[model samples]
Target: MAEPLLDIHGLPGHLIRRLNQIAVAQFMEKMGEIAVDLTPVQYSALCAVKSHPGIDQASIAGLIAYDRATLGKVIDRLEAKGLVSRKVSPQDRRARVVKLTKSGQELLQQVHPVVRAAQGDILTGLDNVEQAQFIALMQKTIQIGNESSRAPQRELGETG
Candidate 1:
């Protein structure tokens, strides 16, 4: 039988949706306070590049849970905006490494405090212990998801 639909008030999916809604709304508001024009996805891409210097475009896409095509467009937009640059990787001529430009670094500096403040606001309800626990649980959940995705496909003659 199919699983029952969850009610909006207390279900896991609903809670996650609500959390995202709140976080995004507050983040935008905080961004306006700091005069940053980038959207959440844009900031995320910028931060990813900043966090993982010398990372390849494909790796950035994987890290951010974005498809290659969509990440390509994002990189294009960032390049157009003078925020990021791509160069042929020294290790692999066929691969392109992505990095933030000076402008992008400056923008990140301007927005980083706002983002930190927003995160602080989000975690305000939780004590340090709870925050740590929450992060641990989230990591565990993601690890489980990764393991399931990497599990071997069943064969016709395979038995478990």
Candidate 2:
């Protein structure tokens, strides 16, 4: 093939962002084929709520690396869809605890295979070992991003 393209192919941030776009596209395509209509993020939040029943929004956001504001919206949508329910927390009345509804559980069961297939499609270019390695590398990169992002000025050798 000719190199008749932009220089982004060699840039990690550019490649990562492009890959995310592609992954979302693939997810949407697969979800459509299955007649499911959950955004990837919403599905993820549902899974988080299922796994951490009675969890608070802040805890779910932390688990998913999602900001509180965005996660709150996601939770709102889930509640609207009746896939999740939030109520005053017994442990902390000031906070709301979220849980999956029975309908949410059923939909999750139905959607699990489709989501798995979407993930498999995204990694079809790699063998099992390569897939595992790729995931490890991505996790490491995210971990570093999280750590450095917290103290960006420290990484830049800047003083407050």
Candidate 3:
């Protein structure tokens, strides 16, 4: 007989919190093996810059669902570590565009496989079909969330 433990399956919020912690912890552990000290948030910021070259700071923060103040600290940390550069956008004087330096790109390439392996480990319990389904569900959730975030605000006088 299986030993009784916390009913994590019955608590979606608890499950999500635990899963996020576990995933992040495992990923960080793997990153340690590669001597990469950057946090997940930093890595995500770098990835945003990598995928969208010359993206503005505000846009990157929005894309990652990070608040401006927190994202600013992440950018500052990355800049201090020499992983990214922020330049005044040529098209928009008030905006600062971000990009990964050559060293940042190389570091990303080196650590990406380790990151993938860590993610794969998190999914090890799931079979191929389950893994695919899980990914599809996550994408769907993100799509719905994005749509909600982008929905226009209603005027004060407007009726539902």
Candidate 4:
């Protein structure tokens, strides 16, 4: 094959996008292997809800660095699947508090190991130490670039 006009192989953004695609594909495949219907975003949202039982939709979006508007649709899907439930927040009725249903909890319990196993596939060629180093470097890069992201992640207790 002829060399491409632009060398995407050397581009961090291109490589990151490709890695993300691989990660998502691997995660979906793992979920499929277990007969679970969950997307990476859905799983992230579910895990966030599990960690923060009364988290609001906006908070979930922030925690997962997902678009808040799109997260509403994701929450709707999870709700339809009986994985999560939303209720009017007592403190702020305008905001909806999300909590995992019993089914959601059980699904997480079953998926945890599968998800862990899928991580290895996502970084297939990397040995354990390399994987750790790669992850750490990626995390550092993400932290540095967070402010530039359309949807920046927010830690708990942070208010925008």
Residue 47, model 4: Cα distance from true site in angstroms: 0.4
Query: Sort by lDDT, best first: what order?
Result: 4, 2, 3, 1
Q: What is the C-alpha lDDT of each candidate?
A: 0.78, 0.81, 0.80, 0.92
- How much RMSD separates candidate 1 from the native structure? 7.8
In model 2, the worst 10-residue window by lDDT is 151-160
Q: Which lDDT tens digits does candidate 3 get at residues 1-160?
A: 9878777767967876777888889888988888888788888889889988888887777767666677889999988889899999999899899999998999899888788767767777998889899989977876666636532222222322
lDDT of 4 by residue, 1-160 (tens): 9867677888899998999999998888888888999999999999999999999999999999998999999999999999999999999989999999999999999998889777888888999999999999999999999989999999876766
Give the C-alpha miss distance for residue 100 in model 3, angstroms.
1.2
Kindly report which residue stretches of model 1 are placed more than 4 angstroms away from their true locations once superposed: 1-6, 90-94, 147-160
TM-score of 3: 0.82
For every model shown, what is its TM-score relative to the native structure?
0.76, 0.86, 0.82, 0.95
* lDDT for 111 (candidate 1): 92
List the candidate numbers ranked by TM-score, top first. 4, 2, 3, 1
RMSD each, Å = 7.8, 5.6, 5.7, 1.4
Residue 154 deviation, candidate 2, in Å?
A: 21
User: Alpha carbon lDDT of residue 85, candidate 4?
Assistant: 92
Off by over 4 Å in 2: 1-3, 149-160
The C-alpha local distance difference test score for the whole of candidate 4 amounts to 0.92
Show model 3 residue runs off by greater than 4 Å: 1-9, 147-160
